[model samples]
Target: MNNPHQNARMTPLGRAEMVRRIVEEQRPVAEAAAGFGISRRTARKWLARWRAEGAVGP
Candidate 1:
C-alpha cells in the first residue's frame, strides 16, 4: 500500500528556516507544497509540527 505521508517527504526543515520562509518570505502553503511535490495539507502539517516542536518531526 502507498503511504500518503511518503509523498509528503517529511524532510524536517530547520525551525528557523521554516519560520523565515513562512513568516518573513510569506510563501503560500500551497506553493511550498507544490515545490516539495506534496499537498497543502502536508505543508500545513509540517508548519504545525514546526510551531509545536521547533522541528524534528516526521
Candidate 2:
C-alpha cells in the first residue's frame, strides 16, 4: 500500500484537525482518512498523538 504519511506531509495542526474531526466530532476515521487520502493507521497514529499531547503533534 502507498504510504500517505510519506506523501501528504501534513503538519501538526492538520493532523490534529483530522483527529479532532474523527474522534471528537464523532466522524469515521476511515472516512476522514479517505478524505485526507491517508491510511486508517496513519489517522489512528495522529489520534494517539493528539491524545498524548492534547492536540500538538504530527
Candidate 3:
C-alpha cells in the first residue's frame, strides 16, 4: 500500500487543518486517518487535543 502521508512531515498548522476537516467538516475519523496514513487512534488523539486546546495543542 502506497501512502503519501505515511512518511511525510506535516506542520502543526497542517495537522490542525486535518483536525478541522474531521471535526468541523464532519469527516469520518477512520477515512481521514487512512488518508493521512495514520491509525484511527492517532486521529482520535488529534481530535481530543483540538477539542481540549483549540488549534495549538500538542
Candidate 4:
C-alpha cells in the first residue's frame, strides 16, 4: 500500500519551515496551508505547537 504520509508531501522539518514562513513573513495562514496542501486547522495546530513548544513532530 502507498504511504499515506507520502501523499501529504511535507515532512516534520517541512512543517516547521512552513510555520516559520507564516510567522516570520507574516504570511496568511490560509495561503500557507493551501500551498502546503494541508488544512488551515492543521497549519494552525502546527503553529500553535511551534509557539508553545518550539518544535513539531517527532
**True-structure lDDT of candidate 4:** 0.78
| Model 3 global lDDT (CA atoms, 0 to 1) | 0.74
For 1-41, candidate 1 gives per-residue lDDT tens digits of 12335544543443235545775789887776676666777
If scored against the real structure, what TM-score would every candidate get? Answer: 0.60, 0.73, 0.73, 0.76
Put down candidate 2 lDDT per residue, 1-58, tens digits, no spaces: 1234665667666776798788778999899888888899989888777777775554
Task: Report residue 55 deviation for candidate 1 (angstroms).
Answer: 2.7
Compare the candidates by TM-score and give the number of the best one: 4
Q: How far is candidate 2 from the true structure (C-alpha RMSD, Å)?
A: 5.2
Total clashing residue pairs per candidate? 0, 0, 0, 0
* Best model number under lDDT: 4
lDDT (Cα atoms) of all candidates against the true structure: 0.59, 0.76, 0.74, 0.78
Predictions ranked by TM-score, top down?
Answer: 4, 3, 2, 1
**Candidate 4 off by > 4 Å:** 1-9, 56-58
- The alpha-carbon deviation from the true structure for residue 52 of candidate 3, after best TM-score superposition, in angstroms, is 0.4
RMSD of each: 5.3, 5.2, 6.4, 4.3
Model 2 clash tally, residue pairs: 0
Residue-pair clashes, model 1: 0
Segments in model 2 whose C-alpha atoms lie over 4 Å from true places: 1-8
